[model samples]
Target: MKALKPRRFGWWYVAEWRLRGMRSYRWTILLMTLGNPVLYLAAMGIGLGALVRVDVAGVSYLHFVAPALLVSTTVAEGFNEASWPVMSGFRWQKFYLGMSATPLAPVQLAMGESVAVSLRLWVQSFTFWLIGLAFGAFDGLVSILIVPIAVGAAMATHAVVMAYVATIDNDVVMTFMYRMIMMPMFLFAGTFYPLETMPVFLQWIGWISPMWHGSQLARVVAIGLPEPGWLIACHVGFLAVWTIGGLLWARRTFTKRVVV
Candidate 1:
């Protein structure tokens, strides 16, 4: 318990300012955040579903695609939070420097920022799920059980972030990060189509993408799909592995930069 509490505090410590603002703003973002999923439902699910004319995982294209959308958006949002926001805190904002002036270690700040960012991503998933509810797009209340799954997506994003920090020097790479990496993952991660239906060579990407794992789990939970117990375990296990592994790498990068 002693070890666990400080780790929890490390993440919480990163988001103190944002949390304070949220408490005061008490800002409800459910509607605003719903915009992307709604557009997704319209453009991809309904738009593309119109032409696909095939069932995936025994559900209509929209129903099958919706839950994955819930998880991917959360994963992407986590990467966004970890990247520019953390960079800004360190570079332009110098907020971490000020926090460093306090007793809060830089490592805690980094972890806290990741966790804070994860919280934002979690909200994105929750809002998307609520929207899924209104449209009758989800199959079961077990859908709510996927919050932790969405958090796993956040960890996956953070992994991308730790790997990203090693390469950063200019603003140009950010464009590459999104265009080359994030975009491809979005399209091919079995979000709109089943992994089995894709070309065999391309299927490898989905196998490695954290977004894909989280997305698949969300779909199973939300729709009450009759997946085998072990398959679900694989999805959840990959995400958990990424989350823990990413935190370790991120700690190393943060310590390397901030401590010495």
Candidate 2:
């Protein structure tokens, strides 16, 4: 085989390798991409949604919740992708060390992992959007924008988590994050209802959560949920900051952990 030069296109090479590794669990991915929407839409959109007759956020419960679900699901997947896989790269599998032996830079490794995670998030978000459409949970064609919105949210969340995970040496922090941070953000970040419904003190959770930012954006596009222009700009800016800042942080941590 010809010797390859990975310096210029190292991130793409790393992304390709990560994608090929995903084949090992392709069935799991397929099941999740398909089954989650069916079950959630059936339960929430049909089961509980029917029970609550009043509209939520100016639309039927199904339409209101569908976008939130899409964003939340992708965000959760972002955590999953960033957590164990990142840890495995450093600790379990030590793949980062192996890759570092080659010409690939540490930053390239981070970018590649991020690219792979983003691609998966896009597919999952798009799948959920299609299923939401079938269930009549969307307003119109413009709702397709929710797909990218969800992906952006997921990437922001994933990048931040990956940055943190790169620094940890064990799973204890991961467990703490899931129980104390992730679960709270999921339940309280305006996923199933409006943030204002909660007490004022608790609303801060949604304000800082990527899920909430993404959900709000998704709702606006998916069902025409009324939001002020300034708030929308804030959401976009917040997620952008998290995504870019997190990627930079991950690059630093990956270099520190893998180059030693």
Candidate with the greatest lDDT versus the true structure: 2
**Which ranges of candidate 1 are over 4 A from the true structure?**
1-11, 20-32, 159-163
Q: Residues 129-192, candidate 1: write the lDDT tens digits.
A: 7877777677677888666787787677776585456336565777778887788888899887
**What TM-score fits each model?**
0.86, 0.97
lDDT of 2 at 237: 99
lDDT, residue 78, model 1: 71
Any runs in candidate 2 off by more than 4 Å, and if so which?
A: 1-5
lDDT of 2 by residue, 1-260 (tens): 33356767899999999999999999999999999999999998889999989988778898888899999989999999999999999999998899999888999999999998889888998999898889888768899999999999999999999999999998998999999999999999999999999999999999999999999999888777789999999999999999999999999999999877
Backbone clash numbers for all candidates listed: 0, 0
lDDT at position 106, candidate 2: 93
lDDT of the candidates, in the order given? 0.73, 0.92
lDDT of 1 at 64: 88
- Residue 136 alpha-carbon offset, candidate 2, angstroms: 0.9
Candidate 1: 10-residue stretch with minimal lDDT: 23-32
